[model samples]
Target chain A: MSSLPDRRLLESWQDPKAAPYVRIERLTKKFGDVYAVDDVSLNIFQGEFFSLLGSSGCGKSTLLRLLAGLEYPTSGRIHIDGVDVTDVPPYSRPVNMMFQSYALFPHMTVEQNIDFGLRQDRLPRRERAERIGEMLDLLKITPLRKRRPDQLSGGQRQRVALARSLAKHPKLLLLDEPLGALDKRLRENTQFELVNLQERLGTTFVTVTHDQEEAMTMSSRIAIMEAGQIMQIDTPTAIYEFPNCRFVAEFIGSVNLFEGKIVERQGDQVLIEAQFGGLMRMRSFQPHAIGTPVMVAIRPEKMRLCETPGGDGVNRLQGIVEDIAYLGDVSIYRIRTGSGLLAEMTLTNIQPRTEQALTWEQEAVIEWSPTSGVVLTE
Target chain B: MKRRSWPLLSILVFGYAFLYVPILLLILYSFNESRLVTVWSGFSLKWYGELLHNRQLLDAAWLSVRIAALNASVAVVLGTLAANALVRHGRFRGRTGLELLLTAPLVMPDVIIGLSLLLLFVTLQQTVGWPDGRGFSTITIAHITFSLAYVAVVVRSRLARMDVSLEEAAMDLGARPLTVYLRITLPLIAPALLSGWLLAFTLSLDDLVIASFVSGPGATTLPMVIYSSVRMGVSPQINALATLVVALVAVAVVIAGLSMRRR
Candidate 1:
């Protein structure tokens, strides 16, 4: 997991005077009539692990391809390290890409595959061998150097692909679903290793991934995209805890959204008159006019079993547990409220399941503080 | 294990016999001591020794081999280019028309192709003052015209199935387009190239109608010689030549199969 403290130290994007290493200005890519990347402008600082997070066909991969110079933008310009590389071919650009398929040349051995880029640059034979040796050792794949791609397992092939792409020592690297082919256990382990590799090498990395957890675990900042446009761009914690819009809130993680209209405003909090017959108070920084329609987005874990039922009716709801999923660490209760809305709440399994207090069809009351959820206008 | 059915076994046996019986008979009679191919007096190698010493038959066979080799080499280059254009360049302008033109030779009758190529060569000779006599160069060109189509068909399927990312990955790692094609693309599609080259060589070697249509004086190929001699009379020497051809083809097939299995 990427803790907030670790990311706070690497927030170069927060510095107003920091210059971006990779700057994409209003980039748009059209395949025939459909816009794959539509006027998307973004800036990535040097040494930052940036991720373009989206579902398949949402243009995250297309955007990464544009950065790699694999796909030319239909409009706008791309600048890498203060140079306009918009019109440069992929080979001429100072960048390398790891394809999602791990496109290792089937005819070549691991050593030859890693040596391909070095040979292209016409490096000296001795230096080429040295670089190849370093890459094999760095990726811990020296034993498989003589083996062809078909002889290697999926994980080994992935390492070979990574070593080959990194052998040239490009300033920036682009990865398209780098860990996508691995199984669940391997993927989780590789995620941390990949982040550590990027940190040690100090190479600016831009990765495209559909898995939100992978993005959250690795990226310094994530750009959430939808339908060829970015919905939000922020740190993982900020994006999860305080999404600017309903789509980002729903897309990142499971959140219970209560549609409402603002009826009251305090110093820094606004009271929402929910459609489900409740007044929900939430902290807000964005200015909103009275009677403006909005939504209060709250995570399932933020809601808790109410201790005082009659204290306040502001953020309290009465419901009957319809289903209980007994996960080892936590149990999720899907409760049907009085207004027929299914409200989900996850509680840590402190006691054994056999002695659990709440069961199916049991009446329960849940409550949350005003600062627990954000008020979204869109 | 399930027992095999009698009817299915008989059908399989009949199918193999129908295909191989003529080849088997020809091979068996190649060793016949009798002058008549229908009768076998005793096993002998006399015909093979005489066939090797025959000057005209040997000359014609040498010419055919040279023409087939040259034609296969040239056809492989041109056909591979066409396959690359079709498979790598995604649906360019006039793609459908080019595809139709490339495939037309596959369906066109051999006689029609031979006649059309003869006409083309004659016109080019008169107007462009090239291919002065329809001998080696002209015959090879004619063979290439039709052989290229088959080569293109074989190479195109392979090029289509190849992962385009391999080339892209090469380019991404600082290899230029030409270097990427040479190192990554060509090596990956080499099996298809080899098979295509062999196919073109076999097609050119065995072709009779096209060679007859375009060949001038003193430019007779092996098939033309074999056809003319068979028309004159059944020669035991020709039987020996046919058996040698069959043996060469069998050795080639075995080698190809073994190489494919190794990969």
Candidate 2:
């Protein structure tokens, strides 16, 4: 408490441009004997849309709570700008948390609920009215001002909640699965709306979600957490393309993994005799010995299927067609190799059902270029 | 096995008839012209006119109403506080025992509560010389002793049914605890608080045994006057008074029901 500089508090105190809008350093939280967040550190530049993506019970929400000052760290410090505010209470901190349940005041009208925080700060009557009006307009919930939370639809309540949280315009905005309560279609649309709003306000937004696609679509950078630790932190493309472990690769997207050993290395590309697929290769940044074991992660769409099948450059494997799935706009084929291993090949519809489709038990070939397969060393 | 419910309905109807027919009969007899009780000579308003002229009975009714109103106000305030303390505040030592003790008035016989309160007041007066005498104040104390139990039960149920997150959400949004309770919690539970108060008021109004025990010479209440009239033998005026009392209760029930329904 004495030496820690709280970044949010400091941002509220200083000019917003001078500091990263949110900073969390070595923040750890414990629930009973289980460490919920173990020494997590991150910095979000002002106006950046950051996301904490993880599986359930991965402590993503806990980390978000620490950032919002809803919960305190067991051991480290939080700084909003450059000042230490590790011990600052949530109300006094310059951050607002939108709860997953929306946590709207049920007895109040939409206008009164949005005005709750400003009224608590003893804002002048006229100024509070203007701010509330601006927020309702910004979220486009002006017509719902007189309705209670239960009367409005889920999307409407969600907008009212967003308006309420943005009423104060704190330097950092923490969203705890903001789109989770909406229906699927509404959630997708609200995600874009949320991104646009954050862009317009230029406020640092920290979102916590278990839905990987939501995180990927909205986040500038994602910190993938698992079991109280942040496994990797990178841009969405980097995380998807260059996962450090099988967990990150599998968690972020559907990837076909084949166990293999590095038989030869040519700079960044490694050639391997995969036990399951019989000769696979990948380009990996992590150095490996000539005989070291690794995992090859290939996305479904990346694997190419050929009827004639005479290719040898990077990751070419021979398999028989075990099954075909005709999904809309695309067809996925399960290719069974000589080793009886299944590799998935997803074909986007370039033609009708004839050219790109395969029958069960038909002999086929599944392959991809070297850059498509990613090596997961850990 | 599917059993017909008409038998159970028949029993309930018989039970209600057993309980209410005599009261209805008294209400009808209040309009009789005969001075003799139990004989319906003709429909008239003579006894009602006589009841209005009975100054002692009127004074006693006023005294009873005053006592019940005062006792109900005190009970509701004290009960609301106790209910909140019991439910919201965390556990402490003797909590289970305290809860049991709080329910003693509700389960204990009215005679016992009346006797114990009278004894406690007399002892306190003798020891501290503060009360000096027991009359209206004593009866009010007795009414509150029993009514507080009802108030606590009602308010505790309301608090239990309440969504506690409303308060926590208020605090998170920057309202202080006192402000949260005032602006959110009190309004949400107001319906319960009102019903609790009205129940306590009615209980105080209807009490006979406890009030009889606690009353001194000047504190004779309406029920005591009515009982004395009944003991003296049924009279036309007493039936008329009973009808008036039944009307008052009916009105109170209607108002209380309307209040609850509005909520």
Candidate 3:
């Protein structure tokens, strides 16, 4: 896990004067009539592990390809280290990409694959061998150096591809769904390994992945994209906790939303006339006038279920437990409120033996603090 | 396992016999001591000895080998380039027309291709005053032109199946287009190129009608010699020559099959 203290230290984006290492301004890539990347602009600072998180056809991969110079943007500009590289070809760019499929050369041995880039530059024989040896040792692929890609397992091949890309020591590295091919356990293990490697090397790493958890776990900042456009860009925690819009809030994690119109505004606290015939009180630092239409969103983990309503002033609802899912670490109770809206509440299993604590059809009170929910206008 | 069906087994047996029995009989009688065709009085190596001493047949066989080897090598090179252009370079001018021209020779009748090529060669010799005599060079050129089409098809299919990202990855690692082609594209498609070359070699060696049209005096190929000899009479020497060709082909095919299986 990335420690909170280091996160704060690495939060250089908060500084207004911090220089961006890579700047993409109004970039657009069109294939025939379809825009793969439509006027997307972003700034990535030096040494930041950034991610473009989106599903298929969302243009995240296309954005990364544009940065790698694998694709030419139909319009706008790309700047890396203060140099404009919009028209630069892939081979001429000071960037490298690790393809999702690994794309290891079937005919070449692992060592030869790693040495290919070095050989292209016509490096000295001794230096090339040294760099290849260093990469093999770093990636723990020294034993498989003599084996061709066909002879290696999937994981071994992945490491060979990584070593081949990293051996060149490019200014930036772009990874396109790097761990999408791995199984669950290997993907998780490799995710952390990749983050640690990027940290150790201090190279600017920009990865594109559809997996939300992978993006959250690996990147310092993430850009959420949809339909060839970026919807939001922020730190993972900020994006999860204080999403600027409904799509960001919903895309990052599951949320219990109360569609409503604002009824009262008292400082940071606001009362909403929810659509489900309930008056919901929520608090936010963002200012909103009375009679504003909004949706109040609270994460499932933020909501709690109790046998009886609490005495404290908090949002509460009477509901029947429609579904109970025991997910080992936590139990999710789907509560169907009296107003016919289903709200999910997650409770951590502190006691392992409490399997039947909340049974189906049992009446329960779902409650949450005023500050736990964020209001979404979109 | 269940018992095999008798009907299917008989069909398989009869099919193999129908295909191989005549060839086997011809091979067996190639060692006949009798000079008369189809009369196998005794097993002997006299016909093979006579074939070794036949200077004209031997010369023609050598010429055919040289032509076929050149045809396969040149076709492989040209076909690889054409395949790369077709598969990698997207939407070039006259792409459809180029594709149709390349594949036309594959389906065209051999006599038609041979006749057309002969006419073109004679016209070129009259107008451009080059290739003055139609012999080994003209025949080799004709074989290469047709053989390249088959090679291009094989290499194109191989290039299509190949992941394009492999070449992109190479380029991302600072390789120029030419370097990427040499290091990545060529090696990945090497198997297709090899098989294409072997096919071209075999086709060139086996061609009779096309070589007869393109060939001139002092450049008679093995197929032309064999065809002329068979027309005159079915001699024991002809049987021996046919057996030698069959052995050569069978060995090449077996080797190719084994290599494919190993891969």
Candidate 4:
């Protein structure tokens, strides 16, 4: 986790001179009439843990399969490490995939499963054994090397699948929901381990996942996809803090969106006359013309209990607390304002739960700073 | 524990008796000293000893075993290939027609199959001047033609139920298509192939009508010999042969069961 900050500084995508390791050019895959992966182009920098985040049926897995050469693009080309491989089959590509189902060979032991790829490359017996041993140790399954897939637990099978995929030391590894099959506790622990392994090996990883927290925790950059098109691609921090569009903002996490029109703009700030009856002064990275319809997206945790309710009504809202959900560390207060808009606010319980001040049906006032949220034009 | 109902117990006993009485009677009579199948005197191994020396029956039995082995081997190969095509190749051209044709023999009466194959062999001999006469080759070919359908059915169901990702994973790990099929797909579906081979062997061994129609004078199968002998009169020697067959099949089944359990 400490290495994350340093890895962020070495972000090759931020540098224009750094060439991409994988370049997909307008890749499109169609199964009959449905476009599984529509015309989409993306460049993944070397040694980066990139994630394709989306709900099911959003074409993320299809895109990953296209990269693995398991599913060829109906049109467009794929270039990996400066070589065209669109026509290459999965076996011939310099890429390996860890399927969502793990897909371990039930007939083979762990050692044999991991040894399969090295054997395919015609490696000598000694070298193959050495590589198998190295992989078993790396995944911490040395003792289970002689066990068949069905004899191992789910987590052990996952490790064996990971070891097998990494045996070849492919230039790029595609993972389709790599941690989707694990229990919740194991999934969280493996997420960090995966990131650390990626950094240590410096092998570019492209994983597809529907878990936003998993994506945010492990990915150096997250690509949000919807309906076979990428909605946003940026660092996890940027994707969370400053989503480029309404779809991206709502998709990543819970956000309270206020539909409004921009009535004033001064430098990097814009004043939007919100539909909830008050004006919202928000920081905007992009310029918005006056009278342009937009949305002010603010996360629930950013909203706080207003200290001085009557001082200024610019970013303040007075409402009745309609619902209070006590969630151990924090409490969610659903405030229904006079305009009949439900604004959700999350407050950390700094004190004991019994000493909390807010309650259901109580009149509460919430306010957010201008920089705490973003204004999206689309 | 619940008490067993008298009615259910009687029905169970009746079912068992109905199925096993004839077999039990035959086994008992096989050891009788008397030559009459229905009459019993003292227990003896004379019929078993006489069966060993019966030249015609021995020759027919050997011919039947050879034809069964050859038919099962050839059917398994062709049938497994057919199953692979139907399962792995997703909706290729003429798939429906091919599937229908493959299963047609399963429902076709043995008489129809025998007559049609006999006609086909005659026409082939007249037109191409091949298959010159019907005997061992003709009988084995006829058996394989019908046995293939049963083998295909068994293998196809197993192949369909298999996890397809195993093969895909192999290919992903850099195995070529042929290597993937050989290393991953074949090993996983081996139990199905074994069962299919055994099924075809039994079908070929049990066949009577088809063998009679296709076989010329010399290639008399065991079933044909047993049926002709029964037409004359029930022979104690045939009972001894039947008992041996049942024992061999039971042993084979036990071996297969044990091996499967170990896996």
Candidate 5:
């Protein structure tokens, strides 16, 4: 599959002159005294595929429902294509949603299911038939046209749902955990297909998913949500490389955080006295004064294990390998440092079969580059 | 395993026989050549022919069919509305009270239901000068009142089991609420409605107590005529009528089961 063009090259959210296609301002929804979505403001550009990423009950799905007009906001305004649709009913809104259940009409055949939206719009009969034909071909389900939803497999049902939602050609498409029901392999394949489809159609797509890998792979940008609020929003790589706070860093991927206080500051490097990992020095662009408590967050793959001591132990430590997890393409090692902190490291197993490797309980030196980790304040 | 299954099989056979033997005997004796019910000299269709010639029983049977059909239709419409309100309306005012009132007749004693309905019709006639005198309309109304409970209970369970997202998906696809109900919700719950209607029809057709209490002199239903005839003596004509009723119910049940499978 060809790689998708990076829509984030024009970071329009940062540019004041660029107009957003869909804008939500101060969106909040409450269910009896508890807020499901709280004061979320976001701008999605045309043809951009954005994902709201969070665990269950974190308000990601609720936000998507608000965009689809499935759920009314308690206090907010939503504008699609410059028209306010906050109070518009779902049937009147120019947006379609692919439900998590797929929600294919069990009584209708695949073709009939895809044609339902077009029929609801009162399109002419010929045009409705043509659109349904196109959708059948696009989703590669022409052979299953005569079969009801119950006859199709999970992945086929999902494609049919996608085809139905897209057949209407709405200004925006909302997906609620679109691939949540598929097996791992099908989910991985469908993710790229969804991105490609969005690119071809040029419709602004907003998807809600708890799978961080899916969001990182398909979304032009992702919003990390926590407790009914957005914690961070950025391109996937940016979010992974430079999470603004502890929650964003931990939520996106696995990380080893060393809680410490800054003891000394040099030109661009700082010396930190970590409570568990001992004294360490690292370079960061983030500016923090001396004696400020902070977290040094480093991804598992960023750390390198060595058989020998390296250069006076700056950004390095001697630790015993406590455990080893041998995944097919890579091996993850958990190391217990002399200071009693366990640091996890992932390494690609590229060596030949004849080569020996470090086993559990062996002492080794683990080191990372000075610029490899980020400084988190919260 | 043999020891365990043997007793279980015996219980199953005994249960079925206990339930079906009387109906089987009635059907068999309906064709008995002898006048004595216990003596089956030979099979004959004389009683069925006699039943065809009795104008009173035929008229009563025809009236029962009409009332049951009308009652089933009215009960289905009203019961579907009640079921939707109970299942879809989230925590509305008096929801629990309305639910209790709708389902109470399902478990309420038939004698109490009949007497209460009789009183209600009498009061309505005296106060509003309506329902001039109990006849076809009163019998149909009474049947609908009790049948509504059974239909509503069946439809409510069905509506509850349906995924709410299906309707929401239709709405998101630009179907208005009414259109969604027609295109998605109705089709999904049709089987339940069919079974509910069939149940209501059978119940109304077989009812004697409620019909007896609410019915006036001119509207004698099939069950009332058959009961009065049997109170005098067990006639072969009554056995023939009972056999026909059983056959009709079996056909209706088979149709219902087949339609459920199609879904």
Candidate 6:
């Protein structure tokens, strides 16, 4: 081999109007009787950072493995850049995967590991050497190029694995829990670096992670999976603020649910005779039949607290402070109403605005703006 | 220490002496001048000088070296493949049965293996016309079959203890399957392969029964020559050859030990 390819080699190879980056149709993986990745069809836009987010056993990793061509789908079609690749072996796919464990080749130094794919391509020796140098500089790991994986720290090993993966100049990159092995601070820092690097290189990344926060911060859009099915596919804010069901409502973030029956309905709002104690007025874009049982989902941060009922908002209820929790930046107050209502209020630490804090057993009023809550018809 | 530990230590020590004493005695008597067996007169290097002149023993020794070298290299490759399959691939239907069959050669008696292979060669000649007669070729095949079991055992344990995610990470990093095996898997288990080859070499060199059953008229391995010579009383030349064998073995063992320690 001559050498590794330089930056210009890869930059000049980029082509537009080539093909659809990846089109997955009804991809399903079955482990005996269990559907690990159910009949799922999705289109990955070119150069998009897509995330598969869910808890463990939700089959997010399985879907990613399918896309990486590590595991074949039982019955489905996979096309990469418009080529049918359902039966293509992982090595033949124009995709590379970064494992959750950040598997760096231990026997070789960092540079050799990154140069592995280029060597496989039988590239000219000069190009291989140049590409290796360029990747080392691009990944900011030139200083550690000669070190074995064991000598490098967790984050450095991750970067080496990434450099090696990207050195192949793959059209797609599959990240399996990329930041899971790092400390919290390192994870936060590396997440931004990964995003910026992906943007700079413009490789379509399909990341699989159980960390909701990491997905929220890194991905352009996330597929919220549950029990081998996607519950919602949207941006992080949309998934959090307007969950389509009770499961999505609770899984993504904390929600205060009031199970109630809608007794009155207006043009765009309704009055819910809550199962707890009072009537709650909620904004409903969803069609709700009167006298039908429903649930109102409200985030604690959206709720405002006071010692007296002075809200112009229609959804107001009086309750006694059952417990007061003083967190560092914010305080959480658990208030109880008649007929078993446990309402939570999160108060920001604005010292001069001492009006929000409450004492135990103190009677208080909790209110939320009508539009801040969602009404789940089911 | 436990009450059983003292007895265990003594047994191990005594076992070491039992194993070493004969080799030590053989080396000492290689210098004998009396010419009477077991009755040492004084020490001399006359037998060593005589051993340098024995062309038949020297040729057999050379043949033995060639056989061991070929067997070890072939066995290491085959054994590493078998070991990877047994470790990396999970249990499917008939896998347990395959494992049982794979390991049967390890504990089977050498005489049975020798006789069965001889029979197999005869059957192949009578039916298939391949390997028309048994000789060095058949002997090496027989040795490869039995020695491969030893090599596979070592490679298997090394592979089983290996972290599997290492290979997965390589694949995830854009390595083709064969490249992952060659670059990552082979390098990681290289120590195991080295020791396995060494083991197969020693076993082929030390073998007598199987080589005897399979050798043709002209194919005289060292152990076959030594076994035939042992029926006659002790010879000065045999002692000289034994001493040389002892020295070569000791040096090889020391090299192996040093390599293992460094690793």
Residue A49 shift from truth in candidate 3, angstroms: 1.6
| CAPRI band for model 6 | acceptable
TM-score of each: 0.96, 0.85, 0.94, 0.97, 0.96, 0.85
| Docking quality band of candidate 1, CAPRI definitions | high
The chain B TM-scores of all candidates, as shown, are 0.95, 0.92, 0.95, 0.95, 0.96, 0.90
Q: Which prediction has more favorable DockQ, 1 or 5?
A: 5
Which residue pairs come into collision in candidate 5? none
Which residue pairs show backbone clashes in model 4? none
Ranking by TM-score, best first? 4, 1, 5, 3, 6, 2
- lDDT by residue (tens digit), candidate 2, A1-378: 133223364433144556565667888899889999998887777777889999899999989877766678999988887777789876677888787888787778999999999999999999999999999899988889999998999899889888988898887888989899999999999888888888778888999999999999998788999998999888788889878789998898778888888899888888888877467767777778889888888889998875455656347777788888898798888888887788888988888887655678887777787888688777
lDDT of each: 0.91, 0.83, 0.89, 0.91, 0.91, 0.84
Q: What is the DockQ of candidate 4?
A: 0.79
lDDT, model 1, position B228: 97
Task: Return the TM-score for candidate 3, rounded to 2 decimals.
Answer: 0.94
Query: What value does DockQ give for candidate 6?
Result: 0.41
Lowest lDDT block of 10, candidate 6 chain A: A4-13
Which is superior by TM-score, 2 or 4? 4
Candidate 6 Cα lDDT to native: 0.84
- Docking quality level of the chain pair in candidate 3: medium
- By DockQ, the candidates rank as 5, 1, 4, 3, 2, 6
Per-chain TM-score (chain B), model 5: 0.96
> Candidate 1 chain A: worst 10 consecutive residues by lDDT?
A1-10
DockQ (C-alpha based) per candidate is: 0.83, 0.42, 0.77, 0.79, 0.87, 0.41
Error of 4 at A20 (Å): 0.5
Candidate 6 residue-wise lDDT, A51-146, digit = tens: 999999999999988887778888889998889988877777788888887777777899888887788778999999999998999999999999
Give the candidate number with the greatest TM-score: 4
